[model samples]
Structures are given as C-alpha cells and as structure tokens.
Target: MDNCLFCKIARGEIPSRKVFEDEDVFAFHDINPARPLHILVIPKRHITSLATIADTDTLVLGRILAVANQLASENGSPDGFRVIINTGRIGQQEVQHLHAHIVGGPEPVGPMLKRV
Candidate 1:
C-alpha cells in the first residue's frame, strides 16, 4: 500500500484538504468534485473496494458512514445528502480504495441520486 494514493493521503504523505479525521477514518474534499459539497470519506486501512469488504470489516464500514453523516451535517445539508459507493470499474471506482462519496449542494440534489 506504500504507493497507493489514498494510503498516502491517510498517512499524510500527500497533502489533501482534510475535512475530518479520527482513529479509524479520514475525510477530505474530492479534488474533482461532482457537486459543490463533494467529499471523500475513507478508512485508514485500505480495503480495495466494497467488493472486498469482509465480515470483520463491518465496524469500520459503519464508522465510515457515521463520519459521512457528521460531515454532511457539518456541511449544512442535514436533511439532504447523497452517499455513493462505487464498487468496480463499471461503477467508476477510479481509486483502488474503499471510500464513500458524500455529495450535497444548495441546489436540488434529488436528481443526482439516480440509481446506477
């Protein structure tokens, strides 16, 4: 994982505009945001993708979501926000790491919730 982008970000080797961080999770603004309030919430430990998550990883998964919730609430979208987890290449999992994309904006965000 030494050469991984997100791993580097988690280790602070690569600078990112961090929004939140804790013992198990880290969040930052997406470099290429699709929405005005786009942030990427990821785990400190690399898990490849959602397809690779194990039963033991459930706790971390929940923590990722909790962090996303807090981030969304803090970003002024307590009532509206989108949590997206792309699983594979077809789903646009550009980075080989488990991360949740939290998107919200002042405009109507309902259409961005289209199921993939």
Candidate 2:
C-alpha cells in the first residue's frame, strides 16, 4: 500500500486539507472537487472497496457515516446531502482505498442520487 495515495494522506506523508480525523478514520477535502462542498471520508486502515470489507470493519464504516453526517450538518447541509462510494474500476473508483464522497452546498448537478 506504499503507493496508495489515500494511505499516504492518512499517514501524513502527503499533505491534504483535512477536515476531521480520529484513530479509525480521516476526512479531507477532495483535491479535485465536483461540488462546492466535497470531502472524502476514508478509513485509516486500507480496504480496497466495500466488497472487500471485513466483519470487523463494519463499525469503522459506520463511524465514517456518522462523521459524514456531522460534517454535513456543520457545513450547513442539514436539509440533506449526498454520500457516494464507488466500488471498482467500472464504478469510477480511481483510488483503490475505500472512501465515501460527501458532497453538498450550492446547486448540485443533475439528480441528487446517481449510480456511479
């Protein structure tokens, strides 16, 4: 995983505009954002995708969602927001590490929910 970009970010080897972090997860602003408010929430531990998550990682995933909710509320997206997890190459997951894209603020393009 040494070449993994997200792992580098989580390890602080690569600089990122971090919004939140804890022992289990890290949330940072996306370098190439698609929306006004776009952040990527990722687990400190490396997991290729949702399809590869282990049972023990369930709690960590749940925590990621909770953190996303908190961030959205704090960022004035109390009404609603979008959370997306692109699974594989066909899904447009450029990065191998599992992460959630939390996007909101301003006028969102197209439908709020669209399969990646």
For model 1, how does the per-residue alpha-carbon lDDT over 1-116 read when each residue is reduced to its tens digit?
Answer: 88899999999999999999999999999999888889999999989999988998999999999988889989967777999999898888989999999999777676655698
Clashes of each: 0, 0
lDDT per residue for candidate 2 within 32-102, as digits (tens), equals: 98877789999999999998988899899999999999998787567678999999977899899999999
Candidate 2, position 6, lDDT: 97
* lDDT at residue 116 of model 2 (Cα atoms): 95
Q: What lDDT is reached at residue 80 by model 2?
A: 75
Off by over 4 Å in 2: 112-116
TM-score of each: 0.92, 0.91
Alpha carbon lDDT of each predicted model: 0.91, 0.90
Q: Which candidate wins on TM-score?
A: 1
**Clash-forming residue pairs, model 2:** none
